[model samples]
Target: MKISKKKILELLTSGKYVPSTFKAIAKILEVKDKDDKKNLRKLLKELIEEGRIIRDSRGRYVIPGENMVIGDIQFTRRRFGAFVSRDDGEEVYIASDDTGFALDGDRVLVEITGTYRDLPKGCVVKVLKRGRTRIVGTFVTRGLFAFVIPDDPRIKYDFYVPPEGFNGAKPDEKVLLKITRYPSPGRNPEGVVDKVLGNAMDPAVDLPTVIFKHNLPEPGYFPEEVLKEAVKVAKPPTKKEISKRKDYRKDRIFTIDGEDAKDYDDAISIKKLKNGNYLLGVHIADVSHYVREGSALDREAYERGTSVYLLDTVIPMLPFELSNGICSLVEGEDRLTLSLEMEIDPGGKVVDFKVHEGVIRSVRRLTYTEVNRFLNGDNDPDLLKHLEPVKKELLVARELARILRDWRKKRGSVMDISSREVKILFDEKGRVVDILPQERGESEIMIEEFMIKANETIAEIFNTQDIPFVYRIHEKPDPESIIQLKHYLEAIGMKLRIPKNIHPKVLQEILEKTKDHPLHSSIERILVRSMKRAVYSERNIGHFGLASQAYTHFTSPIRRYPDLIVHRLLKKIIEKGHFSPEEIDRYEKELPRIAQHCSKRERIANEAEWDLLDMKKVEYISYHIGEIFDSVITGVTKFGLFVEIPEKMLSGLVHVSTLDDYYEYNETQNILVGKHKKRVFRIGDGVKVRAVHADKTTMEVDFVIVEKENNKNNKRNNSKNKAKKRKKKRRS
Candidate 1:
């Protein structure tokens, strides 16, 4: 008696039941039996939920159109939005009026009305789910009521807080508010103050505000149950457990990380094999052994997905008891690890590899700076003492790392593009003292190369076995993005010859061709933005950037949930040699959702980290408001020219309105041309700019052009001529 929803929808759209109510439709469909009628009703409900059919004001079910799509609508500050489909289709634009009560990040059913200037336009028909109920904002109390002004720009309307829900928060203080009622067409959403964060301008409250704004987990507060389990798991492995692992205590294993880094999850060791090959070992802390499946700690870790490292603090996925203690591969401590042994040839090929559980005591805990110095013969007594035992092994590791790097470079055409990551140093009062980039050294690259190889090895092994696994997949870039990139390159006077069969090498070649250009960094960033974002997936789409057929995240289990899952599955495969049918089926059924959840969580963490960095950068730049600095025109848009101060790596906008002459943006040329003066300010042009404004709420900086050097020279020449004329007149 179960009616197919698809059949119901097809019949409704087929026009026979046109404008028919539920009772009439039921009668026409010949559903006389009570059970059959119930099935029909259920089918109708299902169809409605799926957005295939909708009930009109007169209670008749009808299909809106073939263009009806379900997706998450991301609204901008001005109310215009984009509908991001769940199935990864082309985005649909939702005009301000078309977005009916659909807030930012809200899942909704949208019907594509028609094309607007070649872009698909949609209207929100129904809100499937609310993305957020609470928002972090500044509280402003009026006579009888208050409103929370959302910090996120995408939230167009302020949440109205009734007097009772004000929670004693003062005006201008940042507060977290929970929506009591959603906003209708004409009414603003109603909310109540849930928690009062301190003054909005206080430097001390910045991090907390950001954490709340992003719904990031508070540091040091674990669920009581999770904490108890973590505490139990904190103890070092017992002798029995150690006995089960392969002992590598005598190996020259060491961990290289930042000096300020905690929770060291990985260590590396290498030795010269007699056959002219190298034996390299990558030991990762075996967090999966301690965090059991379906346990509170595991659930929490899964929820976090990845550790969020802000400038001064880290919001770890696992509790400190696990992350910084037992799971940390600290020097002189016997830590249990899931180790990867790779026999790499001189050509940087991993000839053979094996994954196994191992027990290792790191001989030294070294920083990248220390290693870099050691390689340069900076033999400080303490550094020498720590590194002397592993000097030969270190030399071998460096050679292998170089070989691997060179091999990767030779194989891929695109030059690896990386920006120097900056760290914000805060004073005791939480004010920014210094913002400096973390120096990249060969030691860092060595570790990176080894990790990449291990990840690839693990992915290859599991992929060939046909097991359900989470892969770090980077798909091919969209054709539209490539087209835009080509136009941008041409605007910059660079010719990019796209191959008939486009691959990573094609993009790599473009980078190589423009390597010496002043706009290389900007071009590289554009190229990166044009590519698809890497995400976790059950499907094995080859990693486009790495040019690898198989790739997965297999290291840092203590910090990354995907790595933890990889560890658990890897351990199972190693033990059983192959997974049973049920095990495979279970993983297949569950991995898609897991991959999606983890990917989403990672994105949230990344966004939150970036936001905090932007806030810190603004705070730092605010001190230099009137100072002029040499900046590069990094981006040109219709509204403004984006400039980057190369020395500080700080970027700000030079708004079109700030220019003395009227400016028109040439979209095709990717430059702004002055209407009256015909002055061209294109990307990559160096100019002096005064730091004009830095706003915290908007997280934006504004810059006005100070006279260019050439202009200053011209003015100097004119002044000299005028002075000479005055002197001649005086003499006469």
Candidate 2:
């Protein structure tokens, strides 16, 4: 058996194996064969690289003691940083000066420098791996040498580019630079231009730079080999293929998506059974059928992880021939799919379910607005023409959706968290028209409920079968974060009792109780900030957000790589009784790494989308500069207050310096109070502000306070002065 790091550490720590050379250690462990000894050496090297093992002066391997820790270093804007332990220990605080050459996202060996207030303080002792080799920045010429300023603020050093490394990049042009040498004692890191990305002001350069910076796929283009394969496999399913699967063409099936949606990966058909149970058939595109394992398409899908939805564009995980054309469950098209046929009771319990490899023809393509309007009783003739037979099905689906929603709420889902999705409208010239919150009506909720149920059903099946799988896990909130959130809420006159062992329902109760309060959004925002980000993991740790013991992404395989993986894993179970031991072992060994990679890629996609959105938001606000906007304080920091315009969905900073009176930040109270003027600005407080400045490059908009509506300090001061004058007159 291959020895794992844990087993090796256990052996060393147990004092069963003497600290010796790798070969000697191997002999002590009864690994006598030549191949076993070689394998043991490889494992030792892996441990050493992971910082779990070290060599003494005599070249004997031993586990690193308590002083050292292995983890990924996260650098913040303020020079200080934190080391998130790879072994899942509490995060160690790293002072700015102690960070040394470790950059953000780098895996390093941290030596515990000391402890501050029960928190472990660490200093970087060794850089195990570099997170980035290429940096994206704007080129600037300084006499003889060119310097590239990184767009990411976390990167502290600018790259010094020699004259030969310019690569035809003009000054102020965006460029991707490759670091040739890291920073030395008194010098900056040296780099050469890898790609010239044209002028920063050009509209075309905006997304391309973000793509290159985030290492996303080349926009709208697939590899020639992948394209050829996609073209070959893009044909419609044949007679034999149709004969082997269930056909759902005659069922009043349809897809409900955004009006601009091109890739429809999931379609639904709901019907009421004779016994009053609901039959919910959620058909997902069978992407695994076309993109086989180890194929070029599969490799590219794995690399992209998920489709990135920018303001108006989507960088799809699959090529257009597959993602948009063949694999997309478009209207009236005979497409291959995997359907989760669930029989849910009136009480929102899944009574029974079956997974099927099927073929489906979506009868209609209805947008969310159309379905929402129909549900709201506005049955326009034009809308009726599109929604036809599926209208009745949608009604049944809506009832089931309400039942499912109630069930989920009872199970601990946080229903009061306001949706943060915003829609950015652009004109024909690609200029911003307006920014508004994306409406979440009943139709959207119905679809969401169905998808959640489908994903949970699939997760439960695989989990019960004891097969290797990937789960979408959202862990409970950290204790420290919960404590901080409670303190913030208490400062706002809201009370939150956090138990020693926190549950999602415990937090959900607080949100539900304050759902109608004026500060509901602020409380929900803090709660969201306090929770951990959901990620893909091989272990089924349960989804805290959905409050499901078993949950995975099973709905949008064409867009998500993990869903595609789930489809493949499920197909193996469907075709064969179960996956072979070898197959199961392979998945067990590889899935954790795949989960990490997909999670990282997902973050990149989110960051890229957010970056483009911020660029557009800045651009939109730049046009309205000097105009006053009614805003609400969303956040308060030492630097200033963060205020958002409700109507426009635009957020800008109200800098402390821009305030007329001197203001002091009360961190514990979570507010800014003017010292003499006594004007108070706390989170959720409404105020009027003028957009003073906006920078597209920085993606920041600055706001100046326009008016202080309730000037209590002025009235109080006037009263005091009058009383003082009256007293002086009486004395005279």
Candidate 3:
């Protein structure tokens, strides 16, 4: 059932005094069935006594006015704040002096005293909940009771630690802190150091740990419990089980991925029909065989929801013993797989398809680079000898991929340039040795195209079946961001005439023209970020960015939990032929929470990746703090200009006050105009700057614009302004 605005208002008006009960009210309003209705009502009584909601003495619902609105926080580096009030679709402006104690990303309740563009401006009257207790910080020993300050500057406070709380940690070591005392009602939150990482500079171990701290379950080096469970579970494709399904192990098949890939979730086998249609088997590893519902491993995988890749390291959802060993499709070994077999002609259309359970033996493990080299007619003897058949299939697959890519691009898909991982080679002491971009060759594209094809096809399959499963859907950008981006581009005397609704094709054409145009990379980034975040949801919203009629994450179940759920849901309806509508409804009600959880955790993983890259960049810059570099002004704000050093991905700030002249920001044009010197700096303009400081404690790099003549001219203009001001004051 669709949510009714009247029913929600009634619950809000009813006296509920607790936060948990407010959550219950949300759930009650969302559910369609009779069973879910009972649980929500049971919790309503507890909410009445918690003062979270007030009941007038006359006995009627009197929810706090602040409780009426909820919004996602928009965090800044400053102690100041503003929340994007989703309830009212406005920026809730917060004064720097009024922050009190709330920090970034903390959800809180506020009173909507002012509405700006239908959004609210209000003080955070209460913190509804603390998202997490664990935070990463570095220790400092001063006295018998030392403290640890969080590496995340937004935390605003340090932890107080006794010797025992150090857990064998020494001074200046990086450690994890567990909040022991929260700033309750009116107090500041304090924590005790719980775990000590060996050193502050050890990147190998700490990088993965930071990835785990975000409540994402990591595939441990050795998790014996899950390993044991995986080992005991039998594949049991006995005669009886095999008889119920089709077996296609004899078809020549192969898997193509990165050279370092351990978990092979998808494989391809191809054959040409008499009428020129192609039968392509997109066999995926049947992960559901090993991971059963409610099992220990399943529970852990559910919690993690996706694999996190930080540079060369992988924090997988399943234990390596399973992901890399049992489930991995090794060459020459028979493995169970769930497949989408498709029949398409040379025109690159998916005319017909079937989803089946089967067995397959991969003939070889092929690398993407080798396939690319072969395709370019620059093959070595080894590639020709070993990967010839695979390349043949890839040629046919690429034709299909080309068709698919064109079809989507023509349909308004927002295309993205290939961004490889910035591989940083480090010395034993964690010092950067070299930095280079990872090569994404032909094999990668072919595999990606195939996986996308399978995902979209199965997404339609699920939509037609009416089964509830999580989909990776991208929404359109908010109006504010689009306007901001337009202004930024116009400041450089260029403008993209994007459609008001911003369909994918317009952006794709702009990207195609802007390729390799000096400011291309940064402008592309703005376009990419101008869209709403892609997340998992049960609804088939029709992925705006991908420009697909239906889309999902069907492949890579070994890495992503939503894909695993998709596989299971698809299998139940496709193979089993019948399923409980009630159960799907249950999933429809439940999967949104998991989808929200997975999306948030994915962001945390991304943050960890950027954190590692930035730490490496900081380490890379420690040696060059005083050196000058040529940079492009990628961003300009009231506070500073962000100059991107293209040779290195390090961005530094040229503070507003350091400009040597009085300047005012022109928000409409994304430029800072010097009042006296009359110089202007905006996004995409080239500027030279000298590094002034690199503060590791704050992860801030300060720069001074390096034109001496410009500075001298500005100083002379400033003196003239000062003299004029004095004359006016004297006359007055």
Candidate 4:
């Protein structure tokens, strides 16, 4: 009998059918001919590859269902377990023991066992594909046996190397490896050394190690095709092109950014209208015009999603010819822009607005520091002369920004959450000299308010028109996370009344209450984590954090791909007013995939940036071992108290075993209590700790508590020794 793929699918979908092996399935179908059996095998393979059927570890074929899920598994840094982000928007927790042979980033089939703490728990049934083919690690030898310990903390297992697989790699050296065999029960994965990076402590290898581990694209490197396209498009606007666009070159427009900023993508101008309103012009670089859809530059930017700023290095989303050349809104240069001019009333309402493709010459390029100083009564002759052309517009911009900020606050936006960002200062030799927290001045907030208004105005326009567009959505926090947050707040001696249907206002209120608290920064971070991450989506779900009805990333097109996409869609709307049926269908089909890819890429960039930052923080702290620093208890667990040096924002584990007294963990109160001394350590407690260890490889630090009396004693000892030396000198 001839076997068809449809018949096999029908058999699998039948209520009476049970999962079976290929042989059992063939026998059930009554395939007697050898050719029929071969055909059946091919059909099964096709179905599995198309995700129509799942192949279990025991070589049985089953239909995908509630009991099973497929996703990429990510191991936790703690190595206790892994989480599988399912394709259907659910996350399943897989314990370390139940992971089977699956490694980090592997696409696996998981069998749902039950729920752990309200989250679905599962075990890896089979690995369908490997996410990584190469691994970077440190090679070591133990009694003639060799192994490579993975540099990524998320990878829990070490790969074994046979004698012949060394490839001349010496022990204690950094080496790249190619996996030859995967791990099994009670057996380690095996690999062959591909290449030697360098000695583990060599600073020269640091950049390559991070780049290889995160699969980051090389900085300042572009494909020949991409570079050619960039150069071709990086041209000054012609007179014909300039005539077609609205002329804003004579307007009092300027850009506000950091002193070291190179690429100016956004500029602003404000004017006081006659009817007690403000006319705000937000001009963004027209990156979409230069980077046409389906072009090499466009494809590269979409893949990058956003720029990655790693310390002093930048892995930019677009080539320099575009990002730093034609697309940049440089001072005194006639640049093309997509402008949004909004007439906002005194109540901060955008009563009328127009989106225009325009050309502008930035009258002045202002730095945040100088503008801030000028606003705060600085009257230096040179500074005043430089800002003379656009100073009045800047003042008007600040006034309008204040009104908008107030309007957002009244609408229940979570605006007071301080983002903790540190600037790592480097000396002439590229050594980290100091780390300072980046302060957000009034100018920074003013620019932010203006951008928010512009983004919201654009998003509202497209959403109300029922057009296909990408939105930046921030969903409400999960109920379980809110409950946990309440518990955490109670432990910190704050009481919160959580309603069944919570709103962003409640979180805003919590932040407001904690603004002056000693642990304000820590509490802010916890609240931020408790909320869901903001992501790009084709559906307009609204932005919870900003408390905006409709929001999209319509700014910073030079750096963000989503914003570039928005620019394209806006231009279409501007030209045609509405999409044709075919255009609408095409965008509807493509927008979701584009949104998902861009969101994933953004996450990858963020992780890579944070990884490099953590590495640098550890490297800086390595030189300060044996020094005492004041810290705050950020976390309390049975194993240890996690403390962070507030000044440096460096965290380390204070193991329970090193404590002066035996401590018992109180889960209800989330505190560690000393059994005999009655001393308690909970989140937000101030303590002085001595840095005991710092490991660059693991990116971990260890700290021990220093008693208050001991610190005083050391100070007294130094004073006495100084007096004795002075007396001895006098006697001589």
- In candidate 1, what are the lDDT values of residues 1-732, reduced to their tens digit? 346876676677774556789898887777889889888988887676555677765788777667777766766544456555453434788888788887787877787788766578878877766788889998986677788989887887888988899888999999999989988867889999999988887887788888988888897777999999999879988999999989999988999999889889999988888999999999999998899999999988888889998777899999888999999999999999999999999988989998889999999898899888988788799888878878887788888988988888788824458664787888888898778866578888888899999999999998898789999999888777888888888877777677545688888888888888877777888999989889998999889899888999998898899999999999998999988999999998888878877887888898888888888888888877666788899889998889988656688887776675899998878899999999998878998887767766668787777775454545444433443443344223
Q: Model 3: residues >4 Å from true position, as ranges?
A: 1-129, 141-146, 161-171, 198-209, 212-224, 234-240, 576-578, 656-668, 673-679, 690-692, 705-732
Root-mean-square deviation of each candidate, in angstroms? 7.8, 8.1, 7.9, 7.1
What's the alpha carbon RMSD for model 2? 8.1
Candidate 1 deviant stretches above 4 angstroms: 1-72, 75-80, 85-97, 111-122, 141-145, 708-732
Top candidate (TM-score)? 4
Give the per-residue lDDT of model 3 (tens digit) for 437-487: 675765576677677778888888778877677788887777787876677
Task: For candidate 3, give the lDDT.
Answer: 0.70
- lDDT by residue (tens digit), candidate 2, 527-580: 998998888989988998778999999999989999999999998888886888
Backbone clash tally for model 3? 11
What's the true lDDT of residue 607 in model 3? 75
State the lDDT at 283 in candidate 2: 97
Report the CA-based lDDT of candidate 2 relative to the real structure: 0.82
Residue 156, candidate 1: C-alpha displacement in angstroms? 2.2
- Rank the candidate models, highest TM-score first: 4, 1, 2, 3
lDDT of 4 by residue, 1-732 (tens): 878989999999999998999999999999979988999998998787545789876889989887988888889888899998765446899999999888888888888999987689999988877777778899999898999988888887789999999999998898889998888778888999998999876655666777777777888998999999999989999999999999999899999998778889999989998989999999999999899999999999988889887767888899999889999999999999999999999999999999999999999889999899888889999999988998888789889999999999888899867768899876776566777888899899999999999999999988999889999999988888888888878888998898868888888899889888877888888889889989898999899999998999988998899999999999999999999999999999889878877887888788788877777788777778667889999889998888988788788887776677899999988999999999999998999887766666777677778886366655434433443443344223
**Two-way TM-score contest, 2 vs 4, winner:** 4
How far residue 696's Cα lies from its native spot in candidate 4, in Å, is 2.2
